[model samples]
Target: MMTTIAAAVAAVALASCAGPGSAADDAGERTLTVYAAASLTGTFEQIAADFEAAHEGVSVELSFAGSSDLVAQIQQGAPADVLASADTANMDKLVDDGLLAGRPADFASNTLTIAVPPGNPAGIASLADLAGDDVQLVVCAPEVPCGAATERVEQAAGLTFAPVSEEQSVTDVLNKVTTGEADAGLVYVTDVRGAGDRVEGIEFPESGSAVNVYPIAALGGSEEPELAQEFIDAVLGADGQRVLTDAGFAAP
Candidate 1:
């Protein structure tokens, strides 16, 4: 009987040495990485903060860049749990390549604007003003969503602009205007809002012809599919839509 009791005691000691709830705790704490377009930085950061506050034992890591660049990274097999593109074309490309888990939903929309330094130092007023010899224009490259939208607007307006630089992202275009690198730039209304008094947004009627829609989805190889879906839902749900709308994004 003493031997049997000692054996039971040994089993208890072994169990104690195994560490209580260590495995389960480790499993609960996971990091979810999200790749999103640069223009969504302000809005998504707020969403990420809200998500982390609501979820216990979970952390979010965000990587923001141009939508085209983000898509290329995902195609190259970068580790990303979620992807939010500024335009549907790049997301559609991923869907066509079978890289995404499901159909991407249009989460939000934005329109292009001409951003200039506060007080309109160059006396620029409209789209035609950008074509003046004295106006130095900064625009996004054709590969980026904002650039493509700008192209459509320009074409629709039958206007030609000799841009001083073709930036990689819309934020870069805004930066040029804020820093006085250019007299004006074609950027999104959301970007202008995010600039926070750094630049003034000019809305042109031609911009209505080329509104950009943002789409988001979970990647097929995401390590945290559940978290990715949660983020996507927050972007499409009422609260998320409110945030986007407050930031100058149009409803999808």
Candidate 2:
């Protein structure tokens, strides 16, 4: 039985089919549910497919959302086999609550960057350019991992931006830029790379000041503990590293 989070903050769930063992449900199938940060959507989806292939009778269910939101759902008793956070801070909340089956492992790291619409519509060349009132800047909320990184970058660069909008996830911010809803948006380097040509990315030195490390672990309340550990292992393995690295994520 798969239990979902509240409809108000519903998460996007994707399922991948494969094979399972003795742990399979009465219907001869086992579902491994993973809650991951939005930034990890592309890479994690690839990893999930590989995992499903390696473990036959298994269907991997992936839910993507902000790191904070995912943690809240897990804390509220959402059913998940594994949890992969975009930043350690949100994962620490679960640790403090003793909601993890074991120690979390650092897998990848990412840094923030400026994303502008194609043709550099706003001419956002540097971090300081986003501070101008003429630029419609969008960014993740301060509570999000990307937002926290943006705050650090602001301090490091000694510049403040009056964002036109604050989104809940990096993808949302990226979407605004792609759709021309905002002149530019602050998102992760990987997010910009994943967007293909929909948005153009601008790198700034201050982004290095706030690199976010990605972590993964098994949830304490997981029904498929062994399966969860296996998935975590897959994420920490060489194939996983290659996938993440190719997706613009730096190794942790």
Candidate 3:
């Protein structure tokens, strides 16, 4: 009788361990990966937090880098459910390559600004000041969105600069200014906002001619298309627009 009782308890324990609702099955929750431009980092991170709060059982994994680098990753078939570029040109490249699920949408826009150290020690005030031999400048690589916008603004102002460094992202350009590595750097207006008291933003009239439009879309071959689409919608919705606007991004 004792042996039979022990066998019965062991069998029940084993059954519970092998039940239909086991831990292994519960681990099937979905995780969505999003690759986005570096400039969108702060705002997108807040958006992701809000999204996770509203959607249970879903996780958003965000990767932030230069728009061009993100585009290259997507083209190389990185496992991303969504891609957001700081400019439409890179997005068009992905779309042309047939890597996006549908047409990309312009979610936000921004213009270039000259970011300077907290006090503007160089007595810099305008675009032409950047060309002074004594003033060191940092700029994004021409291949990146912010760099391209800077180039356009420079051309519009008929000015030239010899930057001390060509950074890979707008954030890097801002960092160079904030750290005093360079007297001035060309960066997105949103980045200037993000920097807050760490740096000061100087407005240049030529920046208006070089507005940058940020585009986002669901990637092709995504495992969670529906969720990806939902994320895209959220980014374009009222709440998302407010976040972008508050971060100094302009309407498309």
Every candidate's lDDT: 0.90, 0.92, 0.91
Q: Can you write out model 1's per-residue Cα lDDT over 116-174, one digit (the tens) per residue? A: 99998998999999989888999999999999998999999998989999988888888
- Which digits, one per residue and each the tens of the lDDT, describe model 2 over residues 1-252? 134455323432221232343222447678999999999999999999999999887999999999999999999999998999999999999999999999999999999999999999778899999999899999999889999999999989899889999999999999999999999999999999999999999999888899999999999988899999999989999999999999999988
Q: Give the Å shift of residue 191 in candidate 2.
A: 0.7
Candidate number of the best TM-score: 3
Return the lDDT, model 1, position 209: 97
State the weakest 10-residue window (summed lDDT) of model 3. 19-28
Each model's TM-score, in the order given? 0.90, 0.90, 0.93
Model 1 local distance difference test score: 0.90
Winner by lDDT between candidate 2 and candidate 1: 2
Identify the superior model by lDDT, candidate 1 or candidate 3: 3
Total backbone clashes of model 3? 0
For candidate 3, the per-residue lDDT at 127 reads 91
Badly placed stretches (over 4 Å) of model 1 are: 1-27
